[model samples]
Target: MNKLLIVGISGVTNGGKSTLALKLKELWTISSIIHIDELTKPMNKLKYDSILDYHNWDEVETYDWERIKKEVTISSQNLLNSSRQLACLLNFYNLHEHHPILFIEGILLFNSPIDEIFDIRIFFTLDKEECWKRRKERVYEPPEPPGYFEKYCWPLYMFYKSELENKIKVDSSKSSNIPYNINFIKGDKAIDETLLWANKEIYTHLLNY
Candidate 1:
């Protein structure tokens, strides 16, 4: 069945998921994008000098997952899928008439129950050093105090990233891989070149439509 496509854009704080979502919205007039950060419950602002040597950045409790799922369901045309729906993505649909494309973006988009609903998953990453430097240039509302990146953000990102890599280790023994619409985007790469590659990937997926 032709269906609404849910796109997941995920990455650590300041990893450029928001920018990409905005651009994708611009590219597809029929698309809608949601930022989970906007729906997160307010928390005490981070302190400039507070140092936590270790923190579990993969904690799903940090986000309001229930509300996110509700909002996505309300906004989407959500066609019913079979109970035996494939556990893995077979492909993606880039466009459809009755069903609008939805892009859900957040730091832990993949960690929530909502993740399994996405037809496409895009991960954005930059070098650890680059992410640290960029954190200083970016500002969070309610305003994080100085040195927050050095104290918490950068370290947690790198740590969780390493863990994720270990979990997704490729199986060289398999003759064919399960089809999954996952893409890794390098933020430090040239924007023009990166967008071109992304466009091509989406275009290829659209061919299936």
Candidate 2:
């Protein structure tokens, strides 16, 4: 089977991870997408936290990383096999070219087990103020409680942001041992620009491959 590249999109809430994933899917017709939200534990299973006084869905602990890893592994194999079959069928008709890239997008992909699964990772970020502004404009099924973003969500994201920065610093110091390839994207920029940046990274990796 040919190599299949896995790309991860993650970052702060309401920071446009989903939008970028959708756009990339449109651009890469054969690519498959796996959203982390689909792999989250059910709401009933999420106990309310004493600190937040609410079910904290923003943290890494809320997600099932084991399940995520399993699903990704399965999906990767499926996409690769499907691509091989498609290539054979297309070649029979005198056509060529099949690039099967898998996009795994989520809010907390930087966490353990999940982070190691990605060949390329893209993080979208915006200032807290901007994030709040855009978040307020959208609606969620499990409505956000009052002070949720200010009291819990934003703080948690900031914590993760700090951790990511520190990881990047450490990785930079060890040129030969970088564990990840994360591209930090400014979420406030134009969508087209962001798409171009992501495309460039993916294409560059494909070329190197």
Candidate 3:
């Protein structure tokens, strides 16, 4: 029997967290994914910032972290109980009884309160220009304010990045709280290239497990 691992995919907005999660699911049939956006507070419930004149959806407080943690914990427990699907990972990876992966992906995952649940964490780093370019390509309801990207999104992302780095530094020194099994991947690579690299990393991790 292999351990049940909760994998966290987190990074800047439009940084391909969800895309990579879906690709991983396609590759590993037995794996399950939980997107953080699905558990966020609705528009009406979100806090509105009068200065920015838009809802502050980019902060850590906007997500119900407790509920998200509970759901991940419960789902992870359930995934561990399934003996039939467990064989699929072993067969696919050519490893005997490899870990069962439960992926939780979202922009704010790294900064959230669920650090204890992650066995492996992958953070995508994107240049600000690339991030803005991708944001422009997508359309959102209640359309982004005139300066949303500049005034709100990017700044918040930087803050979160700094926050995550600080936590990593603390954990590295103390070796107590957050697990040190974190991989940083550049987000500008082609999707196939990123996917291939991620597949290799996951496979290698499983080999050692």
Candidate 4:
């Protein structure tokens, strides 16, 4: 049996990480697909309105850091709870004597403690302007406001990238300049094209190893 894990990372907003993950799911016979966005839904719902209000640093700072930390802590707890649910699902699959390739996709997958779990990591790189533009175009509902990216997500992502680059060997040959990255060919290319490439890579690295 062949087993593999894919972790996708990129800058804060939209860089097509989710799109690529979904595409990979379509291409591969993945036993389990774990998306961190799904895990963070509860936290988003809880802080949605508040986060919307705090679009700028001035507004975010108006609230005490301790209070913000409390909210974040609660959200972190929710993340952990969701992680447990996913873990149970994985364990169930494992116990059945069936080992299937798993693809766990997320923005922060390579950030901090979580990175230790994935066997392979891929980053989607895009310039800040391109990222923000893609995000704005994708927004069906209006986001908090301008400058939200800089005020919130960018700093966290910078910290994550800095730490991640130090931890793993990056494939600099790939166009995506993401910290530790692999470029999975995408776009209007035939599905077979992508699958052929991926299958070859997987067997060469995972099966041979």
lDDT of all predictions, in order shown?
A: 0.64, 0.81, 0.79, 0.48
Report residue 30 deviation for candidate 4 (angstroms). 4.1
lDDT of 1 at 201: 62
Residue pairs with backbone overlap in model 1: none
Candidate 4 residues lying further than 4 Å off, grouped into runs, are 1-12, 41-52, 55-99, 140-142, 168-200
Residue 178: error of model 4 in Å? Answer: 20
Give me the candidate number with maximum lDDT.
2
Tens-digit per-residue lDDT, 34-89, candidate 2 = 99888878877776866645787888878888898888888888887877788787
Query: What's the TM-score of every candidate structure?
Result: 0.73, 0.90, 0.86, 0.56
Q: Tell me the tens digit of each residue's lDDT in model 3 across 75-127.
A: 87777666345565345433433456789998877677786667678999899
Per-residue lDDT tens digits of candidate 1, residues 122-191?
8888877877688778765546665556656677667666655654564333345453345777877776
Model 3 misplacement above 4 A: 84-98, 175-181
- Residue 196, candidate 1: how far off, in angstroms? 2.4
Once model 2 is optimally superposed onto the true structure by TM-score, how far is the C-alpha of residue 92 displaced, in angstroms? Answer: 9.6
Error of 1 at 57 (Å): 8.7
